[model samples]
Target: MAYKAHKLLEGYEKANSDNLPEVNIIALAHFIAKDSNFISPEISNIKAMRNGRESYGESAIGYVQLKREGHITTVISCVAPEHKVTSNGYKVEIVVDSSKGEITSCKCYSCIAALGGCKHQLALLGWMHRRFEDKTPTEKACYWKKSKLSNVGKTIKFILVKDLGSKSKEKRKNMCKKKNKLSSEIIQKRKPKRKIYKVKSKINVRKDPDGVSFLQEVIAHMDCKLKKGNVKVIPELAKIFLPVDKFDSIDIHSLMKDELCDEVAKSTSNQTDNPLWRRLRYLRITASNLYAVAHCNTVNGSLVDILHGAKLRETSAMARGTRLESQVLQIVSKKQKMIFERCGLLTCPEHPIFGASPDGINENFTVEIKCPTNYKSYFNFIDSSGKIKPQCKAQVQLQMHLSGRKKSLFCVASPEFENNRKVKILPVDYDENYIRAVMVKAEQFWKNTIGKFVLE
Candidate 1:
């Protein structure tokens, strides 16, 4: 079964490039298995393992394989990052081959199937429809199902778009015979015996503040703007000394990678037109990104590599991408102060003892931003009936508790583009008094969730 894109996206990678995007398959599998909600979670835990590749590399790239009228069709995709305006975030590549009309082989990127597309698939699909679909009679008719039978079901489905003849009838009968034989053999294969392995009880590890002080230090460094990208990652030596390979271990993350991401975005694409504006934007990003990084980094639970890296100016681009990034960020901070004053947003007596930043204030109403690293397919801010979206409400409620505001709003930033940028808002309507009660519960939960960990 070949992967066929709606469009054949071949040779489309001249568009955008990023860093090393290929990920280990086992890591991808383990991530899908571990995450209870299949969503990525930010954590403060640190562990390291020593392992190397023990298997084959990925096979399919650029296109996803899907069921067509009957046979497998590969749908190629072209991705013109959020920066590419020629596309509406996603561009497709569809091509139909001569020998195999609906068949497509993707030569573009890897794993655009389950994740997302890049430029390669876009070119493929475009060439297929525009060039071939018109000139050939066989191209106009998809006899794909007429040639294959019963991959998903026992019955052979015949779709009609053209008149059939003796030649067509013979082809259908022969294909159905091949399908039935294949189906019977498939059915004869015995199901593997299910194993009944005894599950071990989960041990609650005590959280050790002394042991985790390294993590707190790391976060403190992040506050100073450190630790980002693959260059010069801080190592956690404790994991090196400790042996955690007794039980099978796996990392959990759906890695979205692009080897040419930096190249495409930086070299081929448009640079921000204004340097001053870029500086101002970087400043806002640095602050908010640092704040989020700080909160996710709990005390006594982070790593030493991150700790000192955050403090170092030279090693961590995140800590200090350029002196320019820092200067612009400072300007943005001043700009933010001006915006708050102009918009009549609230200014607290001082910054919160906790990590929350106040986003907006009109009269007594306050809104907070909880920037998610990724955005889901649809923005479910409010349902069809106009009720508050549960996810947005929960995020806003967390900010409210931290800000001590009765009511709070949650604003989401677009994840498709640059970091530290956002759009759209969802405000949680709740009384300060009522939310306070909820806040107490939440705070207690945070402290207690790791309460057992403190003992470890």
Candidate 2:
């Protein structure tokens, strides 16, 4: 199974490109086993040992230490329970294969399962599992509270101005004499020395790569539509990191477009004919893809599409639909006395991998405008009851989640509509359960697939 995301630790556990230790078998096992809900089948062996009276009470395991050495985990128990073989309590050391979740060795004298796990090792495992499951929500909250107080105590120690009480006058005078003597010795060593000679050195500096030259080459090689086969990249490097089998099929120009679009958005220049602006106006997800996100099993397809790295090229029909949406939004805003502001790319605050870019938004609601290209497209998006069809539900739900809004308004608009009656507005509420389901698929796609490659 791929790694599962923890919502509580989302912000704290960021990906480290330099050292991705989380994906290592041992580290991944430790993280999963720490969660209270994790249940391994090997735990049943511990229960069988307990039923046969092969171990002591649950409290026998004490001062346990767990350390990961390479792919193996070494567990040491400082205090162990006494058994029939020996009177005095024995110390135990258990070696575990973290990847396989099996005990490879034990140091206890009474153990018989040399090829397998013995009672002492199993008992320690049960103890650790129970310890995590035993913690209640209140206990966890109190633990954090005490941790904060302990930090505060350490921080406040430096502000103390005086001791609780004074000692004798002779003792104070002796302490002052020792402090003055130490201060004079320190001052003697702190004197500065004059330089006798100086040597000069010349340093070489390197200039950074300029993007304008690269952009010119890309533009010259690009197709007439400016979609794919525009830029060249190192295939072997991409293959070692990316999940795709064919690097040549992956559109490298799309990444350049993303960077250029970001530069255009952040720049203060007011020029309307910027090349980036011309490309950005036509690059957006199509209505057909939006429907798939809401109604179809297209998560895998979506991930593959992202890996392909193709830029969006708008056709004449797509341009007509975009213009229709804009015209309808303008007419609606004036008639209803409502304002709609354009939205930028938004990522979920808690889960950054999942992202959305809605059409527009207001204070109370998220706005998702869809302009159907034809009658078939319009009917496909509308249910029999004249409501916003279920096919586009997922898009608005994601929009609300990314925008942090409570509700969303899904609007279907076209230039042919004369009044509000021809247009449809459907209200969609936020659904956390649905969002979680989608995030699970997204997490697997990111961690197991995209995470395999290192971006340069």
Candidate 3:
């Protein structure tokens, strides 16, 4: 039946027909994953040839046969149009055998005897390759009219593409199930219930000033000497310094420092009037910089800023958050019977340069208060179980690691949302690995950078 249709096109477009290289089905399938360039003469040529062919007129032939793992067969009538033929053009057959890594049959009238191939045969191969390779479910269904079945042929020329779309839906459903199973395994491994406590605290630690005078005070205090020619490393004062080991010193100031910002900057890179590139180029990591070290790759900029004595800019957001933190502590203290001790920044005795300024602490648990300006930010700190988010988890864990407390309670107090202002205690456990990695960087920064600069 396939060869019978090819016979009709033997004399059609006879002048243009010539010997062409054979379409190797094996090489074509391999290229499908890495390239989509097989549609060489452009889609417009295919549509134009289909429309111009007077013999095939408006009749359509659609055959799609899909096999599991090793085989695929596609048969299409008028797969290659011959100019002004007496009957319907040729039918093309493409058969791919994965086991043999070859296309067993690639037949079309133009170059059937040549074994190599013709443009019509190649076009059919491209269509079949695309159909088997595309794995996205159909976004919308293709509708055809029953009364005008033959007329619908023009629009529904590539039936294999639509068939693959429907097939892909089944493939995707199975994939999603496998993904869920893997995710379940991961969650089970990390499943430790969080402990909660409704402790009341009235203590409020005010936000310290960030100015030249404060910097002078911190440096002067570090100048305090012991009798044995040893310098006192005050953990309380260490919070004011930027820990260098927290962030990449080289890439920190580059144009692509922030991934989100990098994407935005790239789209606007061609704009001559944009000042973003210029501004970003000169931006420096400073002591007064307020950023999330727990959520990002690097530590805060305080260490770098202090070493170079960069000018500090006071931010209203930091001041507001700090003030709100104190207010939250006050409410917690009043509601609960427990008292939270007011404290300064505490550093590890071994790594004095690494400091943690926990909002409040008691004998049983340490406190880390968050005052999110918005509801989204507020909810980001806690999950459905009131456990801290993984990003914020590191922060509280570090606080516990430094304060010598096993349990750390994180409280979110958002004043803008009346229902969210209450201090909900979400106790986080200590992460020794995280603290150890941070301490190593802190040690390196202190000994190599800060030690040399300060000692000199």
**Regarding TM-score, does 1 or 2 come out ahead?**
2
TM-score of each: 0.29, 0.36, 0.35
In angstroms, the error of model 1 at 423 is 6.8
Candidate 3: clashing residue pairs, number: 13
Off by over 4 Å in 3: 1-303, 306-312, 334-336, 383-387, 415-420, 445-452
lDDT of 3 by residue, 1-456 (tens): 445432323322211101111233345645432333323435445643443232232123222222233234333334434332233445555555432344556566644532434545555565444433333334521211111123234644433323422235777789899899779757864877335321111101111222222222323322333223353323323322344335323221121113333233343333223333222211122111212322233333554544344434433335567557767877777766678875444433343334455677788777777776544346667877766776566666666775678887788775462455666767677778876775454455544444433331
lDDT of 1 by residue, 1-456 (tens): 453333333432221111111112332334324533222232321110101111100101122222233233333333323222232223333333321222334344433542323233322333232222223233333211211111112242442322221226676789899899778746644545335321111111111222223223222222322234332122221222122344323211111112222222233212233232222221111222332332343533432222211222222212222223323333333544432211111112121112223444433445544333223222345455555555455445544543355654454444332444334545466555643454444333333322222212
lDDT of every model, 2 decimals? 0.31, 0.45, 0.44
For model 2, the run of ten residues with the poorest summed lDDT: 199-208
Best of the candidates, TM-score: 2
Give the total clashing residue pairs for model 1: 58
Error of 1 at 38 (Å): 19
> What lDDT tens digits, residue by residue, belong to model 2 across residues 43-156?
544443452231342434444444556667565553233332222333456566633444455455444542243455545444444433342234321111111112222443
